[model samples]
Target chain A: MTPQRPTMNDVARTAGVSLKTVSRVVNGETTVAPDLVAKVRAAVESLDYHPHLGASMLRRNDRRTRTIGVLLDDVSHPFSAALHRAVEDQARARGIHVLTGSLDQDPVREQALATAFAERQTDGLILAPTGGDLGHLEAHTGMPVVFVDRIPAGVTGDSVVSTNVSGAAGAVRHLVAQGHRRIGYLGGRRLLSTARERHRGYLRALGSHPGPAVHDLHDPTAAERAAIAMLRAPDPPTALFTTQSMVTTGAVRALRRLGRERSVALIGFDDFPLADLLDPPVTVVAQDPSRMGRTAATALFERIDGYDGPPREIRIPTTLIPRGSGEL
Target chain B: MTPQRPTMNDVARTAGVSLKTVSRVVNGETTVAPDLVAKVRAAVESLDYHPHLGASMLRRNDRRTRTIGVLLDDVSHPFSAALHRAVEDQARARGIHVLTGSLDQDPVREQALATAFAERQTDGLILAPTGGDLGHLEAHTGMPVVFVDRIPAGVTGDSVVSTNVSGAAGAVRHLVAQGHRRIGYLGGRRLLSTARERHRGYLRALGSHPGPAVHDLHDPTAAERAAIAMLRAPDPPTALFTTQSMVTTGAVRALRRLGRERSVALIGFDDFPLADLLDPPVTVVAQDPSRMGRTAATALFERIDGYDGPPREIRIPTTLIPRGSGEL
Candidate 1:
């Protein structure tokens, strides 16, 4: 027969330390004394002790797997990537690891990935919900959930979101103040609450004089096509408000191609890298993804730590940055 | 005592299906017939059965936990995030989950995260190593590993990297063709092989008259400072070559502040979002991060699938896109 695998008890006995000390050392708590740590290490090496995390999770009362799952629209997008990094920073600080998935705005994918994470016993979940209803997640009642970027729909939970309406309104107002009554609107899919909120803000600010508006521009290429069509149409708006960064990029390309970049005033929602360095620097209503991420993480941890308060909604404010594009 | 927990056998018996069929359904594999899948679902619900992933991992001979760990320099960085998404896409297609962490070029963090991942029984690891020696990972002999962005150091394993040296040399030659004999270099830490290789390329291409070169600009702020100092110094270089994207942003800002953006030629390595939208449209030698990421994931999955071949090194090519910036 194969030799019996060494256990934490054996290491403790060989090191002449308590089982608790062995547990602490094995769990990487970092509170043990240096000499004691060395002793435990030596004992562990000699005994070839390997702690089974699966078994430990089953044994522990708290069932702390030390892992959390995150769902985003696309992990590669600049905005989503920033939020992910922030969540990661907070999770790492608490000695927790993150498992991330890109939902890609598919409710089916969101439900399937959430179920997969639950089966793996993730301690909690942070998500930018894609579905209209999170009824599927109701099955995992024990797992704490936090929503970011968009508020939870058909569910009660902690949510951290940007000031989408006010931020978008502010961008439109900035353009209107520049004497642009005929301001075009470029936006994302209406399925997203954030997109809807931004469009609402534009309408509220434009107030009775809405110019040409296009929706469902998911990517830059689509946005570019829409911008080109609108510009070619008779009585095209002198200014434009692109509701998303990718949409903004498409609009910029369209303007550049028509040699109208200098003439058409534009303001994009969401700050992108090298925005200021652009020929006519991009003006933007910048949302703080990092702040939103940190807030969501904090709320999730609070729930995990047994905070049973009523669900809270936190909104991070946005800033309107004035650069050459909007000013023109 | 609480009601006895149900097992896969119990699920199979209740559903009148074979254990293998139950296993396939529980594991989320999509080969089960519609009728059989419906029966399995009903039985699972009635019995209130939940699969214990930990137990399943221990019981399986192939020992696939269906999870992989990824270590990146900073998950928020555009290049790193893009690469991560590519890996995630491939992994998700195979129904594998990803655990990601940011190493921030800290060797200690790299070692600690690697060990943490190993202890959690991740089937494999993909990393951009921050250390010169990967001796720390030797303990996780069972786990397959793949390296990205930079080649493996002391240890040997599968690695997918960019044409750092050749790409840098090509960028320098492009600047030379523009009649720029004096071109300063802005680079990252020499601790990284990529940084060193890039600096070497700069030196080789410059031949007899290498201008002021600065090393260890870790962020955009640092690069901006270095660029400003270099420009203000006596006999400033006629052009600048920034070896990284963040460094390029800094150099661009510095030149703008000095009111010499139009006068000095520049070419940055690594394409970022909106590089073309800049005033003079920043030129760059772009590395195919998506391709690099896809290649790394493919190599990693190959290892996990029991391709026990010798260590392999794969290099993805880079392309030079000439916008107005490098031509000045």
Candidate 2:
């Protein structure tokens, strides 16, 4: 019932002694009576209670913390938040505690957090790694690490990510099929591998007809400006492909402000709450980030449980749900 | 900079010595040169390094972990997610790590997380406490805890919550002003004080004109069903006031599906992303959860800093944002 491995308290209840006496016996302090110690030891043997961290470390082959570090991009973002929830669900089921940190796409912060979590001897780490030189991480920490949402740039390890490139291409294909020759791409930061892969997919789909591609759009204002500028071009894009939900929101805001909600077709990379309730419901290529998180956590847990297999990269497929905008 | 409290590596860099020498100096091993030890000591002093838990415990007037535990209701929820971000922003500024967990409105889970955090020697705790007997927590854990969003029923502590009753009442008043006498209330689970307070507010506002009031609607599906059923009633409600964002989304979905979006006036309790982009942009009694989070975290930090002031219950006011739904 306590979110801990069988504790000394459980032993005390079985041994008919106080927690203090149980602690004394467990710590091998000599002052306790032999009979009480024997009782406590018998109870401990029966209950399988490792007194504390030190005892557990001494007894088990693995110096298990029963805690995992989860470094996400931003827990405030719905995708990251949902992923956190999913990971937590799995960890709770396993009686593990997850310590979370928001990396905020800062590689230095990512490394710093990973280092701290390692210092605490966490069972493993789940990282939605930020871009830049992350090769140092695997060697520097010497800890089991699993990548989530996006693969780490340098070292190949256990990772679960959405098929970003394919999903983006599929979105473009959907737009193209709807007779849209020119589609604007409003993507996330170029530094992110997600953005890069999605951009590649966009280009792959737009092999012949390359439209205006704007990368490094995170804030709604920047996205709105980029979308508006693209809309106002001499040859405007008839359709817009936003790489993220927030970007989609910005583009939608711009459309509404410009009174072109129904005129320009929009399909976003992520699905958000109330997307269908929009004036002209926004179509989206949705990635299952929660499933990705669960998969990544499971993979990490497998590694922690001594699964010595080659690193696997699991790709979760994205789905395109059309409401009103993508068809037009 | 590393997220760790100044480490041996940091001392080595500051003192311009090898990490080995720094470790030797720190560990008080006899092999370190006097000059090197002096340099390391100077660097440690200048960097304000508290070497480890034991050293910090010995040195400090108040043993601080520089880590805070945040137990949110459900971090995946937009409200809780935003709150987490806000709290993290404040903690990061103070060079403190925020260890987060979603309690899922489970009292047992809350206690377990609190105990785990306490075991880890977290400096303080911020809880969006689940409803139940949490009286033992203050005395049992011996940790400073600040409640956010909902108050702890048994024990008194610093808490920051929205003006739920007033907010809901204000929202109902807005709906009534638009000539809606029969309004439906789609609220959250009754176990939550936030939900109960909001329901109380709804009743307060409808003191004279009692309408269809449905409580304990947690998910969007329930909200949608309640809305649909209420709409189908012989004396159906003309307006809907959903207490939460998710509930509002469900009601909106149902209304949209029923093609009664324009017909039924709606005002949601919490504001969410893309609310303004909806066909008839959802009117909401907006609670500033981020600000509430920041306030709760600040209050917690104050307590952590040895502020023995009486527990403060800070109530953040809510705003009624009227777009078109409420106006209708």
Candidate 3:
């Protein structure tokens, strides 16, 4: 059995003082008499009592619950996890707790979670919005929203995103400069704006060369299968461009399995752990999700403090690190 | 200005129906006629109306919010992220939302968070408690609590953890079997029970060799520095026993920096992404954080549904994968 902890009442009884006096002492009020304070402190020490600051803060009518909600693509995904941590770091510093959820690209789920935050006393919302129309988000207008990673059409809010279009275009140009014309494109679901923009960049760079073998799929397994099939084809591309980090990993695995690690050139969008450790070390266009998260969170807090200014769209620059894979 | 979303009033006006009729239609009342239903549906589609499922359920006092809160050491850490995903998966299946926080090993923060969850209408809490004295949790004893990853010293609750002691011992024994007598132990913060238990295991496994060099560190930088010093020592250990994934990563970095990866053996406690991709694939005693999270959540839901039984201590087994790094 867990030893029962002494409550304020217990401390009061032990110290021959009122419960209010014990609470005052525990909360560090200096109004109490020295002798009474000493007794209360001794009782508190004996009982190992801790005054619950968060609990009492929530009880006040005007005091903030000091909690925010974050809805991302999926908390388990590496990108989402990194972004979540960045937001958390910013929030944690301000004594604000984060309540997070995975949107799963479902508009219905997004609506439910957002409106639910309205009831949960969450101060604000940060969303990497999915689905076509986030118009209904206006229903929860009183609550501020900060869009990260992906910005939805039909809903305007403060957003922080990466330079997906130019980043992808730059990667394609790098590949072209290496004298490789045939390049397959592995992309994420077209519903995501990042995927669409990356695909557009590929098209823009592809002035010729059969428009590059394109496979737009969601998740790594599907991307891996597509890569395998494309590589096995009669006239497979000598190089490939994977849009997302997950897709990049899948493409890497597929190429390695086919014994073409050095033969096929690849430049992936998004960086992942161990990318530098992979055989030939995967080259990628690295987007700063952490910075995006931090910037979006700062903007959200500004809005939460009643910033009625126009919503701003912040695009972070991307970096291309060439190790070995893209060199081929 | 952001476009205001159409509310029930707007929908009613568009459909030329009463607010009650619109409400009835949105609530899916069977009394509505087919023609009226069609009209309401068209209005709903045009306005993009999404029923607030989370809010409505919360309005009912007796209904469970179906939201479980998880307090981890850090949500961004790969172990925590993986565990969080597992919990979210379990909660999502039952139409539950997960509210998570990172405690960062502060007792005050932990208590504040735990008590705040009490007020936030969380149905259950899954805590990887960092606090040594959690007696104050008695203030909110009504809620169900499941300790995951780390068990609190003073609080009694259900917990699901990996076999840290035996796992570390097994790895140490493996290193010994490989004919390595001198070994160095690189651990996480000693305050963490996992780190302490792992160190104890290391000591237990060091039956003969004058107790291997032990360095208890928190961050990767400290771990890397400690590893460098230990490796450069006059009588350096032939192998290393890293307690956590981050520590393992730091040790790997140090070993690689010194060009001693192939020469010095390492058996890390926790397995992380890209461990297999490292120059010399890292061998590790892999704890199933996902399984721990799933089990902990399952227990939490069981408690939420009135499992008044005694607290449970679930210890999931760990796996040791023999990769290239541990073989030396």
TM-score of chain A of each: 0.90, 0.86, 0.84
**Strongest candidate by TM-score:** 1
What are the fnat scores of the candidates, in the order listed? 0.76, 0.52, 0.36
Better of 1 and 2 by DockQ: 1
TM-score of chain B of each: 0.90, 0.86, 0.86
| Model 1 interface DockQ | 0.61
- lDDT tens string, model 1, B1-328? 6244577899999999998999999888999899999999999998767787887877777667889999999988999999999999999899999999999998889988887888787989999999557876744435789999987678888889888888999999999999998999999988888899899888889888798999989899999999999999999998999989999999999999999999999999899888888877899999998898899999999998889899999989999999989999
Kindly report which residue stretches of model 1 are placed more than 4 angstroms away from their true locations once superposed. A1-40, A46-50, A140-142, B1-41, B140-142
**Model 2 stretches astray by more than 4 angstroms:** A1-61, B1-63
Please write out the lDDT profile of model 3 over residues B1-328, one tens digit for every residue.
7464356788999998887788898878999988988999999887766554334543445556677889888887889998998998888789787888887888888888887676565788999989568886744445789998876787788888889888889999999999998989888877677888888888888875644465558788788899999999888999999998878888988998899998999999989986876778899999998899899989999999888898788899999999989999
Better of 2 and 3 by DockQ: 2
| Candidate 1 structure quality by residue, lDDT tens digits, A1-328 | 5254467889999999999999999878889998999999999988757787777887787778899999999988989999999999999999999999998898889988988888788989999998566886845435789999987668888889889999999999999999888999999988787889999999999888899999989899999999999999999999999999999999989999999988999999999887787768889999999998998998999998889899898999999999889988
Selected candidate, larger lDDT, 1 vs 3: 1
TM-score of each: 0.91, 0.86, 0.81
Candidate 2 docking category? acceptable
